[model samples]
Target: MTTSDGEAKGEGIHAWHRQAVNDPNPQTLTATSAGHARRRPDHLAVICEGREVTYAELHRRSNQTAHALLAEGLRRGARVAYLGRESEHYFEIALGCAKSGTVLVPVNWRLTSREVDHILRDSDAEVLFAEREFRPVADRLRPVLPGLRTVIEMDTPGSLADGFLDWRAGHAETDLDPGTGRDDAVVQMYTSGTTGLPKGVVLAHRTYFTLMEHMTRAGLNWYDWHPEDRSMSCFSSLHSAGMGWFMVGFAAGCTNVVMRMFVPEEAVKRVHEDGVTVMQAAPAMLRMLLAEPGATPDAFASLRKMIYGGSAIAPPLLRQCMERLDCDLAQMYAAAESGSVVTCLAPAEHTPDNPRLGSVGLPCPGNEVRIVGRDGEVLPAGRVGQIHARTPALFIEYWHQPEATREALVDGWLCMPDAGYLDDDGYLFVLDRLDDAIIVAGQNIYPAEVEMALAEHPAVAESAVVGVPDQRWGQAVKAAVVFHTDQRATARDLMVFLRGRIADFKIPTQYDFVDDLPRNPTGKVLRRMLRAQA
Candidate 1:
């Protein structure tokens, strides 16, 4: 990556790299001793499966894990795969990798063995840290992965099968060189694979530090955080938002809480019992919490800020949350390539009186957003077009994908393929994906409009709309809905519901009711999967 004014170079990145090189932050150590030095090391840092790991213990264990990896002769920049469901070990291993200066690759546990194999192969991983439950899958693929140097099983002795090294034992807590700087890659996140096969998105140390600085200056109010602040994270560490956000909370010296898996009732209980002040989750998780019985304002009384994103939050759901949760609800819009957040709807703007209730809010400082037409012409306010952005947090490139890198980035700007428009007040409103649009009789119809309309119905809990090939109108609108309960509704009733809300052309020509709709682990509806079923 060459440094040029128009080619994405900034003082923030340079300064952060300089600081890491000169005097590395002691907090970078993933051990309890360092955590104790900051303040109360005995304070809780992780809570999962009814077990708690204090900051001191979490730090110590992570440091030990780092030594174990180094003992295996792992070098800096070596790609190591972390394959497991949510657990305290996930945090320990991830931070351990960071401490060792080895690039961490977190694979989604929801993926099948085949999918996991693809990622391991594509990443050229040298080692794999896997849970005992997934040992069988790993054993099956180990032969195919010639580059794999070791397999560390994350389970107690006698729990793992015969051929793997015990991850917990057999290494001295030796200090390793910490490579901190703008040039060092810290993480490699795979794309969601919604459009196609997933590609690795490499993020550098400078990218993360720059994002934190941008958020702090742009009104995240994160500087107010203290050691007493208890933060909870339900998002997986594999994604940029999950691990990235948690690291920011850690940097602020807050007690970090973790959930092994997201259960709405358990989540509510943890907030009240743990006295969590800040929390981050997807919109679907929020909806589930609100729908639970006995859920009320008191359930979230300890919460100071509730951050939601990764999917659209319908108007009704947002309004209901404001009335019931009684906490500041903030929305963030981001992508892996952009290092997590590009725009955010601040806590103050999340009011009933705010006109841009459904809008994604303004861009962060030093980030530029433009709505451009197909011909690359910039569109005026309120005109729907492709959303493009340029920021210092942007990734260097897609690993080993030169053609894809060239197509996605143009003149230092990332062509986000999402369709949306900026309002006169500069607030952005994402309509739908540019590729997901349907052209019927020369009129463009976005599925998000129909999905939003269907979401208004009391019986409809969640919905997804797609365009299917049609000989008559060139393409036809189709909808797949998941209901709140076992209650059933006919396609005619839904069509009537939409007829009164939107234009006739935008209404779905076909409706399918299923037990549940297909969604990725992050809760993004896989329209391609739905369309394949259609």
Candidate 2:
């Protein structure tokens, strides 16, 4: 059954999620910056250390960058890749790629040259941009990247450089609007390949801008930017939140104080010094900041909001932050495929006694978050099932992977295979990645639940759980834990502590106490690696 407006709606769907899914105002992503540039030309748009670029100046520079790309014999939809941290040059070139109708591919800087070569060759990127820090690797990749015609090195502040500024300087600062539409491809980001080779996820202008429009139309205040808002752009540009949030800020003509990369102390200093009003962090970064000696309520007094995701926030740490930072807490849930707002645990829902504290929260405007049973029927509240979502903020398609895209994007919904459920009040509690779920003797076990339980213990620093072959049970749960410095614990002690926290069958059958678990650039544990070890 569908809603009157034709959105998929029925018994299991929440009324709170109905409006966003049913009717949405979609806009091209480029409009976010272009509109502000033409309207508020003098407003500050990007600030990276000593450099500050206004909307008017940024518009002109990016226009020149577009002209340079087109002059280099590139055509619409041609690939241009960036391998570095975020900066003024990064944003101008990225936005410029959109204006010229080319796709901007953000290659993870942390990847080895070989892995970097794979993305460059796979994306068929004609032009490459690099910071001085990556010159050695980027230089090594030229031979393998036959299609790469130009390698422009950007001179980052307080870092080492080359012809990027001069290259962008050579072209005329003239508008080159290629008339790219809302659905046309703009950004291509490679996922952190846990199991095999990374796949590029193609995102369009509408995927970034239309969602913001819909949220604004729905009167979501988080979507609205304040007059003097200054956002800390610390997340790497390679991830969804990295570029997505910057685009959102640009659309609102908000000032973004860019950080080349995340340093716990430096991040805190930027907030206090820059008078930042808004910020986003992964739980890992948040933890480090909270532990930093300089971190205090006064240091974060300027902050009005703190957005976090990429993993579940521990209740203990959540309580400390709520009391100390004294700002609204918004735990967001998103994916590279679905873009950022699958759900958000809004500030109002962060009350101390809220049972749904760990939930990813309700859907953002213009999106629907629903749980579905194995039979493909939508499940009612509190029923555990696959968490599927439908939003305009979805990728255009997976680059060169048709079958995978077809299976994932089913029937107007981007069905993320995350096992979760919505409460009666519409809060989403994410259990585990369906691919990561362990089947032991035909009974299902989620590793995240077990890991969370283990995290509650004082001695446990972090952990990664995986399923391994077991003759008796077909598959057995195993955990690789990282204990805190100067803390002590045994596998037996961890097992004992987890006794009442989770099902006995869900407990790890084997434990490997290690220094640390393998993680991607985004801080997601590499469970597949742990399985390989087992």
Candidate 3:
């Protein structure tokens, strides 16, 4: 396949030329299964905890799962909550729910029982497919969720709870009637917001397939993937990247090596032993793997691609990963609202010689990106502003939040509240979250910019910047820093160093040195935590 320059030409300027431009009908399990069968029937589709499931077997099990749900009187459009660690069965159940026209709500396994209960109640889930490991927490909340009618234990027949349904017994060797088309909602992903509550992001079959097609066009070779190509994902399927990337692998008929929990040593060992060719992880995971004692390049020799995203990658770390890992490195930039990948830094750009070292690459073939000021005026190249995008894969709306949806969607474009700039060559450089912007003595200071500068210091391992209350400046820049190998630096030293690199006003006024910074599982810094500490 040849790469396009991604330039607009005449009337076709708005269309994504490289992406799978045709709209696929809402993808039911049957369609996905058929696609798999036609592509590679005998190929391995999933491998969880050393157990393998072929594409044909995956289809059969999904069919049975759908039939079982139907036999249990699960009406069309009913919300079914799936709570568990990443497993082979998770994908099957999710696809089954989609085929049955039921919304699959996969809750984050790391979430506390209270968070779990809130999602279940908020989504109005009728039944829950829960893992035995979390049975205690589920049981504690079962009585509180009035909308929850039943619980299905995902364990062996004899291990299930007394009143709960056993998933093994529910599986019927029968095909289910595939329902609906591309516009139907398949998954409702809950993402925590700045306001402290989580909101459900509704993704339909059309949007999901649109993203998949976009990935394929961007050089994800589904046909080239082999049944024995061991793929591993440590990110929870509850997140957009986790679910979306896993789906892409499944659609390609690659074997998915599941990690119930993320352990750096275990992940490294899995790659070497399983012949893992594809791996998706956050920068924190990369940092952990790199930090492992005696870790060598050969540890990841089997990997063909190492996908890192969810947060900005420090330049030093990126360089280390390129030098240490014997594989291609791709950077994905996306959001839950965008379904999945919107922009990607190809493997070629991962080299140290590449000029666009800090950029997140050009806009996806079919997607149009622009930097706009607060007044919605488009900024010229190299000017920092809010990033806005228009794509067919954009989310329909924030679930049950019409006003918020209206605020986000303007003239068919999603106004992402991320501060960034596009270079002359169209490469995007994200500065920071708009909400985390700090105003110091009337000048705007983006935390990411400062953190990036701080990361350049040899002593700094990680850093997070926040605006804290101040009497004189109204708000002052405060940095929370984690150092490498017990290396220490004074706040005055950092401020002095930053003063030479940036504006004097943008230099951090205070510093709190620590062992680690608070972050989400995806490696995204939680600025709220720093603000709370302040």
Q: Estimate the TM-score of every prediction.
A: 0.89, 0.91, 0.90
Model 1, runs deviating above 4 Å: 1-40, 157-170, 218-224, 486-488
lDDT of each: 0.76, 0.80, 0.76
Weakest 10 consecutive residues, lDDT, candidate 1?
1-10
lDDT of 3 at 451: 87
Model 3 stretches astray by more than 4 angstroms: 1-29, 156-165, 168-171, 212-228
Deviation in angstroms for 395 in model 3? 1.5
Residue ranges of candidate 2 with Cα displaced over 4 Å: 1-26, 156-162
Model 3 lDDT per residue over 449-489, tens place: 88888988889999999999999988999999999996888
Reference-based lDDT, residue 80, model 2: 96
The backbone clash count of each candidate, in order, is 5, 1, 3
Over the stretch 100-146, how does candidate 1's per-residue lDDT look in tens digits? Answer: 77888998888766678788989989999887778788899999889
| TM-score winner, 2 or 3 | 2
Between candidates 1 and 2, name the one with more favorable lDDT. Answer: 2
